[model samples]
Target: MKFKISTGACFIFFSGLYSNLLLPAMELQAQNINIPIVSQHNALVLQVDGNKNLSTIYFGKKLLDQAEYNNIPELYKQGTDYTGILNAAYTPSGSRNLLEPAITVTHADGNNSLDLRYVSHTITQVNDDVSLFSVVLKDPVYNFLVTLYYKSYFREDVLEQWSVIENKEKGAVILQKFASANLYLKAGSYWLNQYHGDWAKEMQPEESRLTHGIKTLDSKLGTRTNLFQPSVFMISLDKPASEDEGTVLYGALEYSGNFRTDLELDYQNNLKIISGINNYSSAYTLKPNEVFTTPAFLYTLSFTGKGNASRKLHQWARNYQLLAGKGNRLTLLNNWESTYFDFNENKLAALLKDTKKLGVDMFLLDDGWFANKYPRNDDHAGLGDWQENKQKLPNGIASLVKEANNNGVKFGIWLEPEMVNPKSELYEKHPDWVIKQPGREEYYFRNQLVLDVSNPQVQEFIYGTIDGLLTKNPDLAYIKWDCNAVIYNAYSAHLKNQSHFYIEYMRGLYKVLESIRAKYPKVPMMLCSGGGGRVDYAALQYFTEFWPSDNTDPLERIFIQWEYSYFYPAITSSNHVTDWGKQSLKFRTDVAMMGKLGFDIVVSRLSDHDLQFCKEAIKTYNAIKPKIWQGDQYRLSDPRAGSIASVLYVNEDQSSAVIFNYLVNNRYNEGSKMPVLLKGLDPVKKYTIKEVNLYPGTVSTIDALKVYSGDFLMKAGFNPDVNAERPSVVLEVNEVH
Candidate 1:
């Protein structure tokens, strides 16, 4: 149940649900919080004014209550006066492990109460003047997430302080308090920032231009309103300003983490806040009130070594070694379009022959080998039934696997393990197997039921089913795991009021990956949640690569691929081809190189010239695959700003490197010679650069591209008039050794 309480200067909120799975009920207890004067740096002092007796905080039946106030500066740190706070209560309950603490915090005026029921052992520490915070969920897995919130007041005329705290590695630290505002990238290292008003997805303020030195990008004063209601500014670090040495570390203080080459903008009507967890941080803004009422929260976080994150990433990389790793990187060909339901072994083998000629290494059967009924047996009928169709391939999977192996390719199969069809045998046997409300009609999408991953039996069935296939065929090279449709009407048979659709679903997925890795430590697995539908770090840490998008249009990929590169490692992206409508083949190949280059293309139907081009593109990708896959990427232009240029560079040896630049759209006037300034170069080295020109009647590597010291000028322009409006350039260089 949710509740609202108002006091002399605070608004207390009661959220009954706990945030994550890490604490139990037995150890948690009800407690009260007193607004104390927290002084920092000896130069600045902060005090939560106007509140005294706050002893009304309690839970159902109130089993345990502790009100001892002890300032443990060592555990919580007291040297710094300006810092953020993130605290949680842990209680051991029954046999369920640990549960989160639930209690109400009554305000001094007795007009408001803030009930905190769910918490994870996470905190955000903001010190000094820089509005910033960090997330502290210890390695080896911690059992809580800490969140802090307070009502901000402001005059209706001013744009005040309102932002979210962040950490360096985790990307973002936000309290997505409302359901209407959705995160654009969905998940990654995220931080929060509040503009003049609600976030304007596409607003580019003229005052906030890229700077070369340390300078405040934005400083505005506005009244904070929780849904347009008058309140003061609330500014905290999503990512601290100190996080960047210069204004243009890469480009701007982008919300995009290490790999961000693009910026995504959104405009919301509500007072929405987000976070970018970084180092020791804090939020300090004025609260204007001649009279007020309500209570707030202090969120703090602690930092671990950077390896805490890289270690997780490394583990994931090893687990999905088939799409990565040396020698073991399985080159795969998926027949999603070719055999949506029609291809048998002969048809598959025919494609495999062509795939082999083009250096393809794995033959994958997509979406149609199990159901004998045509269009009728699509995602709806054949799902959950792993049996191979007799008429489609009379020899069965073993024979097909053997045939593919003989043709110099490994075999893989795709499955949506999280769903089942009503027509399937599994569903018929246990109608209660799927998640459903006791009486509400369960809606179906793609003619399938959302398998109850929350149920251990369901999880076991999935794990055993896939494990059985792999055990039967030790030669299986890969598995394409997919989850279709968005989650709605969430219900878990094993949980009550436990609408942990996101958390539980992720847990089940991790369990599956863990089991897979434990059993087959070397098999490569690719994650394809309806083509980047479920793209997030939680999943990336388990699978090697994620299918970027089903849309292969190079034009569309420019933005999608650009954004994906912002925070994630390049090797995590999986590019594929489908029968996309009217897109230039050159552009498609160009975009595919941004990720793990492969052909989802149909060579059998393409012209000889197109087919040859594809072969050469593959070879080109192979030649510089190391750089594109491992090199650092920079976003030369912001798509949000109406420019059409995105560039990625590869520098493996530090001696030689290559770049891929795309002119997304010719928005600049005919005479505008857009500047192409290269980044991530050794400013100390006097290197030589050559431009690979593609135009007119011939190709030439003009080695005359001049070099300029990065100390003074950091930009150069390319003459579009010389190469015509439709031009692309590849810069190759060798460092002066």
Candidate 2:
């Protein structure tokens, strides 16, 4: 079904269809344009004119096949109407190229810069669902060549693009800015949806109308810190987007270090959005023949609104981004709040037994595991010292691991391998290994400093520490990897140009991850930036799950999950059920079910009633875990706009489903009530729905069992009493004849 532009012509099959869908590929247009083109069915079409300049043909439901061959210097001023794919310093609008430049490089002469000139392009069919479009761009003036790659998954309604910039001059070239991908769209009423947050709050979805000038989100932090993740964004140009209806252009960058997402409206009203690395220093020097490749920028357009847009992103991530595929979502329990930095072998053994009693699958020992040499009792002392704290774990982690396995729990350890404490033995021995300028005042977050991971020695230490622990403990099934601080001094001892530190830092971090994964490919890993800091498909490529935020508040988590669901899979979320102070087991468990479900509070200390609730919830979670991972996720209710939040998951085959509805707040005397419309169901079939008492005890007017047509369930909807302040209901819908 997938073919390339062989010989001289290529075929495009139209694929936008659903209720009253239109324009099937059967109604084909034999007509071909002079310019060569590549397309993903009829939904998207791309072309390059005679100048070897790329242009958009079809994006989403719009067609932009018209070519502007006439050389109008003024048109370049009117935004991206006639501008080529790559804008450069050699252009007529040099220094004022408002549109996002694909690559920025300093010329050898120091005055004469480079403009992107077309070289050649090739389309290679990689697989049935994937096609790679590679275009070569040259900055002849600077002797620089950039190879742009666009990989299209025709079936998934997704396209990813990245560029490799190579310096060909005998001397070095100074790289200023580089974007993974730049896109131009016909402009109109534009609104940008961005997920913004800080520390305990991450992925709080927010939107605003975009006006003229530029709207930007850039993260200068070493990691894709949650404070500002300029990595994923959704744009609505012509109308205010809704959950289920409206044109939405969704994009996510695959890089984790210093990123920026730029959206600008030109003088002509056209829009240009760019996603790529943030030039923290604009001093990255590239040696001749050395290539710098940008991260893959993945994007897709959905006519059916943000929900569908998110589904495509989530699907792409699960299918192609995760380190492991469709892994089990075991009921994991963490001993963080339970015993912050205070726990020993005895405490852990008791907790492990409680986890087994509650049917918890994994026991993640969070923080304070190493460095008895300098005593890592808190955040200040002992980091980077990857030795066992003999006092804390007198017997080491062997007996604990063995006991955990025997208790039917997978044992995972927490480690912050990318950071070091000045008070630790490791830092005292190798003081220069930290990321700091030689003569500048050093900065630290959480009493920890980042490692100049660019150094080969540092990378080796990190890799060995992690690989050694995993190897030593054969039963170690998971890792809670944490990076607590951002780059401060941004200097590397081995590198002269400090600007390249950001790029090399990621390279070194990724190298360490690769080394560890090569040794323990199947082990599930968690990437935590203290709690919620680092996020992006590039980091997601190595980590199995992410801690959304340290705050486990149920009401907050619903909104966080809603935003994350669009770009990341539930499996990648470390949604822990935490009884942080007054939270009940039911409310916490219900929210955690939306992600890679886990526990954080002390289990053994819980009352009998609470412990019973935990046992029952895990049993329910185990049965429906697969469906949650592989199902089509739907946001039945928006938590922000209303007091009720609801989510539905339907199996790929549509034969089974699980729905979770929670009352976010107590506003009205009456129960929080709404008709939750279901999606991704076979309307032709009948289904039996049963109300599951997942929380152990709850009051609801919803019937115990009922049979309904899928059509009725979607159109008429199911109404339940979401009255309790933290009340919730779980529905098990089965296709029954």
Candidate 3:
């Protein structure tokens, strides 16, 4: 029997939608909501319960039977319907639904949720290859309107989801909990793979078997800290997952602030996943006519394996989502590790002289350039005061920028506009602009305080300050925006509504970035938060490459870059080489060439031989960037937990290829020679391979091996002796016509 929720509750017999299936419980009349599932060639599919509360069904593969919906009531009773078309039970919310309370509000003077029922849905064409679906639901008792958005596009077998919550009630309603997207998958033995690490050591790929409960990863320290990240993968691991053969479901929240990613399994073995912004310390209060929009949650499923899943993300990032906008071939040098907080007009001129010799594209002038009331010789002072320090750079920024441009290198400067120092003039003027709990001891990180971007005044200050600097220096071609502190007590003295801190803060930050981007549309900038802290899709809208990690230890970087490549293309990563008294320059040069090549070593200090070598390396990076940044990257060997690590990049047409190989333990590890099987190539084509070993200590050379067909090379593999001193080699291969 079907029932309808009229002003006067009544029941009606209906046998149209559910195939005339009989049910024991009083069921709601199935609305004529025809949710269309677009699955071509059985690559991927989506099924929605438009008949009820817009619930999601199998979305990955055509693995379920249609008859399963005939007896939803039986499934509901057996605890299998954690994703019940409209689950309102405690058991469902507790263990099955990833979000604790999909809907929470204080409407009747306390925490209560009125029954939310289905309303309607719509599909709109976005472009030639993309479409959007919006499902509307309403809670009559509380009068809340919830709209769920799902966007599907061609290629990569991907979809994006988010939610919008509006207060349709007469009075204000406190939204205690909300989630962007949730998914339910049939029972299976699944394994979870995720990215985790610390500051300057981000993107450590890890995998572990999923037990029979909730597995969660979150960032509560605000600013999407490196601890618990926003990127993760849940793949069906009947056996071990490989590069090209397994069911892998990858997901990431396009948010830069506090976020949560969870994978939960119910007792019935059904799996549920929820990902969105973290509503940890505050619940947004929505006034009448007010609405809250969550950041986009991107996900994709691949049956061919985890590699294809990663390649899909990489393709999207480079083709559509990159902040660079397109085809940017920029090589640069950053004066941070070499000079730190010390520099002058003369010092910078010398660096620019060296920059031009190497054919470098840009010269990035890092921190300590701006300080009006306080000396920013160290990290403790001069953050908010954006004026140039006359004592350090006697020539104003415009003058310095002109000098760099005269030398053929575009000049860029660093700014921490969203932060303030207690010893700076800006903080002295408006201490209230910083975020701090009233009467609290007030915590500080990196001797700096985070600005309360939620406050309109602070937002304007950040925008105006950076705007002034760029306007003063039109020759400036780049900006390195660095955020060095985690948010705490994100309180705004100007706003009485404390719950809106996260949302408002991010909004303000975006407003400032967007304003700058509008003014300087052609300049390329990097997003850095003490290194690799704010590298997400949300921030990618405004910034170009992101500094992956501060620990440019090339050995450690090999693992870090590999993990990051799973979701992002090399174009969005800026890598640098350091002559850190320990590692050989050759080893570091080869590592830096793997991504956006940057230099941190003092130029004038380098020996004549070392400088010439660097010049040659930069030339190589310049020639190969277009392919490396836009090509299909394949992990030739595991960087972590393996004896040999390698990466391969092949152009879309398979006309060119670049490969890098690193030996884990040349002298001590089990393998004396590393054998690597190249992948993602035209197997029938013959190829000419050339070797360039940066490390002079390496004994084995690429010239020792003979070129063969891609098929033979992939099958027979190539072996390189693990030189006792340096064990890294870089190879360039071209298709031989």
lDDT of 2 by residue, 476-548 (tens): 8888888878777778887776777887887788778877877787788888886678877777777888888
Q: How displaced is residue 197 in candidate 2, in Å? A: 1.3
Ranking by lDDT: 2, 3, 1
TM-score-based ranking, best first? 2, 3, 1
lDDT of each: 0.43, 0.73, 0.70
- TM-scores, all candidates, are 0.60, 0.90, 0.89
Per-residue CA lDDT of candidate 3, range 1-737, in tens? 11111101110111232232122222455432234444331222223333344454345454355454333433433443435542231112222344445555676356454445556555665555555666666665567777666766556556677777778777877766666777666545777887777776677666787777778788877653654464555556454568878877778777777777667766766566777777776687777887777777787777778788888878766655666646584677778877888888888888888788766888889988888679889988888888889999877888888889889899988988788888898888898998888888778888888988878888888888877877787777888888888887667897888877776777778777777877886678888888788878778877888888888888888888887887788888888887652557877888888878888888878777787778877777777777778888988788565777888899988878888877665456544254688888889988877776453233445563455798977887766444545466777888887
Cα-lDDT of candidate 1? 0.43
For model 2 the TM-score comes to: 0.90
Better of 2 and 3 by lDDT: 2
Q: What is the lDDT of residue 206 in candidate 1?
A: 23
Candidate 2 or 3, higher TM-score?
2
Strongest candidate by TM-score: 2
- Total clashing residue pairs per candidate? 93, 2, 1
- Output the worst ten-in-a-row residue range by lDDT, candidate 3: 2-11
Candidate 3: where is the Cα deviation over 4 Å? 1-51, 62-99, 108-111, 227-240, 669-674, 693-700, 704-707, 720-722
**Which residue pairs overlap in candidate 3's backbone?**
200-550
